[model samples]
Each structure stands twice: as structure tokens, then as C-alpha cells.
Target: GAGVSQTPSNKVTEKGKYVELRCDPISGHTALYWYRQSLGQGPEFLIYFQGTGAADDSGLPNDRFFAVRPEGSVSTLKIQRTERGDSAVYLCASSPGTGVRSGANVLTFGAGSRLTVL
Candidate 1:
């Protein structure tokens, strides 16, 4: 894929159902990130993976939310016990690295998976 690709561009599920959103970052990108965007708020970071390990996951709202990048190129975000409040657009992004010193923090975002809890 030339850019980040997300599955199920739109997902409608009932409360309490589980949802898994998949993200495939561009080849060669080592940094993968997951974010959530509510109605009007900007994207909120959920997790960041550099390589096969999660570099930061403190933004995960709870234990029900988990993300993984087993091979460092593809990632999946799983949400359990979905609630109405969970309705939002799940976004995935990728970059070369954190960009702190390398100045490559630029991120390319996926089209996003809009999850609507009914």
C-alpha cells in the first residue's frame, strides 16, 4: 500500500460488542501509532509502537483497549465492551521514527475506521 490502510472504513456495532480495527502501515515505516477522534476533538493518541514493541501505551483508556504490532509493519486495535461513548473514528498513522532528533516526526494517517456504537 502506498499509504496507511485501515479496514472497515465504517463499523456499526451495539454496546458491549467487541471490535477490532486493523491498520497496515506503509512498508519500511518503523513507527506505528493508534489514535481516537471523538465528535469534535482532535485525535487522541492511544498507543505507539516502534518496531515489534510498544513504545508507549499510557494513553489507552482502559484494559479493554489493546493494540499490537507483532511484526512492526501491521497493527491492530481491539476494543472490548464497546460503549456509546466509544463511538469515534479510529485512526492509524506511521512514520519513520519519533522525529525527536531526526526531524522525521511527520506522520501519515489512514483513512480511519469510524465506529458507531448503537
Candidate 2:
């Protein structure tokens, strides 16, 4: 019954460095999603995985952003060449199934991984 969790609630790095943010979804969840939120804006979808496969990754901003869920459980978001524009809260959520309307869309978000590129 563990909820989703992210490491290093806050991260600070140079503009060209790389960072890896981790997420641990709840037990028994079959769907996991990643989202990024800027100040005063809603969380934007990044990617989603269903049973170890990326169900949707269209929201990934660019080549600098990537994610993986190899075992349908834990996931990680990797950022390359970090930029100031990349500073934001990275959130992770998970649900019981893959259907958007099958109660899987009601995401229970982690506190978030706040990244700061200086």
C-alpha cells in the first residue's frame, strides 16, 4: 500500500549536467505516469507505461527527457543537458489499470521531484 515516491525532493545541478529522478509506484498498480509542472501551471504529461511498455510518451518535451519502467513497477526520468527551463516539479502517479476512464486516470501524485538547473 505504499504510495508513489520520488527521491531528492529537491535537486540542484548545472545547466549541462545530467540527472536521474526515481519513482516508486504503489503495490499492484499496473499503470504509471510522469508529469512535469512549472510554477503556477498544471502538470504536463511526460510519459506513461503500462506493464513495462511505454503506452504514451508523446508528452516528452525533447531528446533531453526520457523515462523507463522496465518491470511495470518502478520508473525513472532521466534528463540530459539540463537547462534552467527544465527546472520544475517532476511528479509520478500510478493506477490499477491502463484505461484512462477505468479509474486509472485518477492519479495519486507523489510530492514530486523538484529540479533546479542553475
lDDT of model 2, residue 40: 99
Q: Which number leads on lDDT?
A: 1
TM-score of 2: 0.94
Candidate 1's displacement at residue 82, Å, is: 0.7
The segments of candidate 2 whose C-alpha lies over 4 angstroms from its true place after superposition are 100-105
Model 1 segments more than 4 A misplaced: none
Predicted candidate 2 versus true structure: per-residue lDDT over 35-99, tens digit per residue? 99999999999998888999899999999999998887889999999999999999999888765
Clashing pairs in 2: none
Tens digit of lDDT per residue, candidate 1, span 1-118?
7999999899999999999999999899898999999999999999999999999999999998999888878999999999999999999999888655845478999999999999
Task: Give the TM-score of each candidate.
Answer: 0.95, 0.94
